[model samples]
Target: MIRFFTTIGGFLLGSLLITLLLIFALNPSFLAKQVLSYGAKSFGVPSTNKVDKFLDQTIIDGAIDSPLALTYLGLDSLNFLTGHKSKLGDYSLEKSESDYEENLKQLNYLSRFNQNDMPEGNYNLQIKRFSLDNDIRGYESFRYHSSPVTQFFGAHLSLVEFLTDQHKVNNERDIQFYFDRINEVPRVIDEIIGFLDKRAESGIYSPEFVYIKAMGQIDTLSTGRIEEHPLYETLEKKIDEINLSKNKRENYLGDTKDLIREVFIPAYRRLFNTLESQSKNAREMVGVWGLPNGNDYYKHRLRIYTTTDYSADEIHNIGLKMVSEIQNEIRSILESEGYDISRPLPELYEVLNSEERFYYEDSDEGREQILADYTKIQNEAMKKMPDYFNELPKSEVIVKRVPVYSEQSAAGGYYQSPALDGSRPGVFYANLYDIRATKKFGMPALSFHEAIPGHHFQNALNIENSTQTLWKKFGYGTSAYGEGWALYAERLAIEIGLVEDPYELIGSLQSELFRAVRLVIDTGMHSKEWTRERAIDYMIKNVGSEESEAISEVERYIVWPGQACAYMIGRIKIMELREKARNELGDDFDIKDFHSAVLMNGSLPLTVLESVIEDYIAESKT
Candidate 1:
């Protein structure tokens, strides 16, 4: 959910940079562009320097441009930058263009330094330089091929979540900041509406599915009464919990209600109207293949997500092969357990899901038990990590049920990283809306994947690490590394004896099979030209997923493009490298050491990761 925090920085005048950061709260762009394209000689600071002050300045300056990012990263509390907490961020097309140009200049600025001459010890420099070299590809080749208000990442919907979840209202200043940000909604909405219209004018309309989902979400925002709305009600509840007097609380509520009526509601309505107007012209286009030069865009997204240049057909073939191998393995296990091998996958899943022993009751108590079980599983997983990981993250992880309101749209499970400053622990959300997704047998692997030994562990390590710069902790393409790490964690549990039960082992395999299936589904929709229904049907028949789960997963792949492929591709690379190290080291090979080398550096492209592994092996041999 975190956007990439670019640092347009170099070692230079500290006073000038500090002045720019202070002024950025009011006009971030002009000074930001100046800071980004500043004197080139400053970048000549030794590349081997682990504590690159220039790079730190770049991240801080770039982050200053995005007010919402500060709140997410917990940097809003910093004394020098607190003025931005009240502001929303720029979503104007002009800003997008400026960002694209800034990236180009950043690349040029990076070229002034000596990438090849960089110290072997400073992997951060290598990773950042490598990332910047590729950051502009997606922006340059397919800028108009994507939209902000889509089914997955709609700005209108995100605005609500950001305010309710991220915007902390602690004192009088924060309370006013909350209302002040609300006051900026109309401007933000106007920019989004304008961007949508402008994109549509260029034949870049979102598909029927995208706009329809967005309009429905907007309806949720626009249709509710002012007081009953989640935004207002949440504020009322928060205000009540705090030490404010009754009169002050009433005034607060009154001010918020007035803002909702005059500013928030009308802005959402305008957004809704725009989406409705656009939906009429929306094509049934499901894939990027429908856009102008879409095949190239899909390839670019593949590079962006997977960090590998594997073509669509190659990925499709890999998915096919993996599906066959995994299904055979699943059949072998079922046969050993005396289950009928002749039955279909969906029927097998039905039998498994129907076991009342695996599920809780359909009541509030059942929901609470499910959450408790998840928490138990997470706690257990965290305990075993010290033997495997050399550096255990101090930050803890907690399991929480998805809020009833947003659970409808939530995935089965996901991890939110800890705050960069360690003020917040990582969170793993289990959506109990669908009880089938919370099957007891799957808890271990799911817990391992979403919490301990997965996202929380890896992300917390990145956030807590003293050596890595801010960009490494919060950069783009971390998802490629992260999703892979989480997926790999599912299998890692089996090796570490976390999945000792026979059924739980099947659960682990099933989780992997789901990712393997994703590889095929993603490539099928984008490259093989499979319709949405075809992809959903394939999953239902192959993985025995419920139709609803299959539909949601397929829709996610449609919107995200090549992201689903990252899990398997990255795991394959990591596994391949591990095997190479193991074979070379033989008796000397240590799983703990191998893991340290992988996790110690911040997330990297698979290719760069392979380089890191090679260096580790060579060092070990010496």
Candidate 2:
């Protein structure tokens, strides 16, 4: 229930999971409509073939077990799925272990049907099998290292992020569902702590810095000020917005305050205490390499995130090469503009960042302007989508600031997918914790990467794809595929004339340089055993990164190994594929068709994505 959206959820839980399993049982006509929605008419229909049916069942089972995902999909809007609204499902290590065991059984069952004859079946069966197998391997190998609590993402932050942003209330029944969810926090935190205890038994625990940061976050949240807590504020606001009597509204607010004080605040304190104890046993090293079987764990992470068999050494070298090349490109741009090239790289960056025009005032008004400018940038980008994409999503993307309380450790920017029922538009969350950290030059690249033609574009298209099954349209996992596409989107803007200023062009290249430097620094810290300070220094010197930004990025790589490598590695593969397509197809290759080949399949393993593009080339040649 907690990790219902990660790569683990993709494989062990079956990336093919689609909660629409009940469609055929409840309404055949409706099922037919869904199946025919996009004309191929195969994915939405449950196959009569036993092999296909078995695959469908595994995916459906995983979805059913995740009430949190169901709610995110707006399943609560459906009469059939609303049962999940009042539950958080199981959020324990015991549950994950059992789920892993069940996946093993499911994998074995799948092999039994491989030789079965059928006229029709899943065309992407090999990819599906590969994904599930990969999931099983990671689950067996790295479960201890893959703690549910990290500074980057964990129950400590996710509970607040999800409840405030994702959970919605419209009526009294919805309000009741909200309260039922509030009452589930204690059990979830206890379950998370139980998992932490098990991980500690294996000598795997958060670094002291991480646990300290987590403890601070928990303390901020669990301050016992019910009136001020985001949970109370959000729900109370919802209660007031709904068409309810004054007495009913007061009763709801009073009940919510009780839940916050009695259930939530206490649960957070328990979580805080657990993390406090873990810090004492925490390892001193920054990398997972310091843990039991840490070397193999890092390898597993690279394979999953990059979706390729790239060794740490190979990735490290790639990073070094790209970093040098990108820095030259940046210098050429700045030097042409008559800036001194003799200064240190960080000094150059310092000058660029110091420009008064590049930053807004460090005030509330400035933060609001950042959000507004981001929206305007995204809106303008939408104008060009029709020329680049044959199929554009109907779902709109919106810009918002990261919630005030949790922005400290949050990434500078990120995207959240829309609610499946169209109740929510996709959101691009810019971290405005420090208004000074967000410079104007970086806005265009960040906007494109996290919003238009980046995450929002790909994700919304996935949701709107009539031909894909519920699984493909929902949560097919692979970080490289998604992050790579977004990274590529940043450069695509420069290619297509979206970067309107010389400084903006520098921002785009600097962003690319940042990702490239990640490859070197991430592998350096995790594989070469570089210290945290060493990695931070490398980023600053190489990428001309702000010290605070460098520190944040380095620490992020510490907790989430292999993820930082995904952006550059992914973008490289995508660019290579585009060139490959263009070279072979000659005049036959259309950019729009190439995009369709890359994106229409939803997030894919780089290997699988290559195969898909190759097929597109072959079809075009005919």
Candidate 3:
């Protein structure tokens, strides 16, 4: 009897193993999707709502992981304990190789998945797959240059700041968590150093200028002055706000100070030393154009961001054509304003730069004035948006100066996505490092792009749409779609009469020209092997931006290849669809309804977005 029972059990176990193997072999993507579905269902989100919910959850998850995300969310300090830390360091050639392999595998798996198997309404999945594929290709291209200077290694942006921002010291447990993490920072730095050393051996390194700037930041961070230390200020403020016992609060604060001085400061100092040592070997040329497979990498970046495969030469030609068209418009504006048509574009740029009405002296007062001006622009833009777009977001928008420490490397402006719960407003962070750079004429278009009809409108609507899953609403966004939309918004403002001043219109043209030049410079450096100086010189001549600003922009492109191409590529696609809709529907076309269709699905691959618009145009005609 015992022998018979054992034989039966063995047979059942063998049958179960075969079935499991068959399921895994049949469809790994299906299995993964099933796991994801199970996880989503556990959160009370149905499979149908997977796209939206996935977006929201991913956004929240990213926030949980990224310090920069926390800062953007207005959180005081990041909760790093909740996020996973990367084991790979700057020099981990082995890890880099492994990462590349893993990326390729993931990409292959995604490419094999049938998009048709996804629910029709679940556009987010398709978008996600496209995004993932883009990342994999990007990783594969730049796997050789595993240096910290690159955006991939610029992990500092999301890592340190995110943790320090949302760190709450309200309770004993919270204080302990802060201390515990603070204590571990040295280990993290050590890991980073080890990674960097590995990278150095592989001949991948940052430029001297980058290290010098990075060291200066480290010095500022490690000086241990409470007033200057953003981390200390955050902790003290949190303690003051909460109902913690005085003794416990004092103890926590003391411990925190000790940790900062001993662990955090030391770690930063070590990192600074490592950077200083490596600075000597750093290259003067800034771009991935010199890296292995640089051309292929850049092409992949362009495809991922723009969701198209237009060649660099084609993009460059388009930029030149657009620049000519915009120049003609500027000439009309100049003629209208009684300015000389013969004045050179560069001369005009210089004149515009020096105009007192267009600039404010660099000061705190000037920063406040800019913010106030931004608010005024927002209100005016809001009044005009109803003419163009029907789906206006209910969320409020605010403009603030970029944090003092980060402002130097930051862009002229950036948009922060609205919170999941709608408790906080969307933000447009303007870098007021140089008040002159923040020209008044650019304010109107900037407001429209960063707030109102731009990021704030699109992002808030994504979050607020009841039909979308959390993932679909707040998941990772395509840089092309997001930046392209913002760029497109600038043009839309002009159409609605927001850029009344010729100089303002000039500013708009300059902005568009800047993006166009990016295609040439980005591809030139990464693919054509143009030196950093070549890229910068070309930018100064064509874009008419300040040399310093041009250099920073070039460096950004180098570190983040093909990303700059998204604006023009995305804008063109959007415009093409809009024109197509207009032609098909003729007088029946509703601008509001058109915008609703574009934004209602949230951010999507350009191809998917085009199909959506095409369908909407057909529906409207009926």
Q: List the residue pairs that clash in candidate 1.
A: 7-58, 7-59, 8-58, 10-54
lDDT of 1 by residue, 5-47 (tens): 2333333345467676677767655554454334212322322
RMSD for each of the candidates: 7.0, 8.4, 7.1
TM-score ranking from best to worst? 2, 1, 3
Which is the winner by lDDT between candidate 2 and candidate 3?
A: 2
Q: Which of the numbered candidates is closest to the native, going by highest TM-score?
A: 2
Off by over 4 Å in 1: 1-53, 79-82, 121-126, 403-405
The clash numbers for all candidates, in the given order, read 4, 0, 34
lDDT of 3: 0.70
Overall local distance difference test of candidate 2: 0.81
1-622: candidate 2 lDDT, tens digit per residue: 4466567646555444444556556654355433323332333443456655555555555555677876786656443433667777687877887978887887776676553353432344555666777789888888788778877788878887778877878789888888888888899999999989888888787777888887888899999567999999998888788768989988989998898898999999998998988889888888888887889989988988998899999999999999889998889988999999898777888788778998888888988899999999998898998888888878898998887787887889999998766889999999988776788988999999999899988888887777655455543677899999999999998888899799899989989998999999999999999999899888888876667777777889999999989999899999999999999999898989998888887678888788778888998999
Per-residue CA lDDT of model 3 for 476-515, tens digit only, reads: 5787778888888888988888887778887888788788
What TM-score would every model get versus the actual structure?
0.90, 0.91, 0.82
- Whichever of 1 and 3 has more TM-score, that candidate is 1
Off by over 4 Å in 2: 1-52, 78-82, 113-123
Give Cα distance to truth, residue 420, candidate 1, Å. 1.8
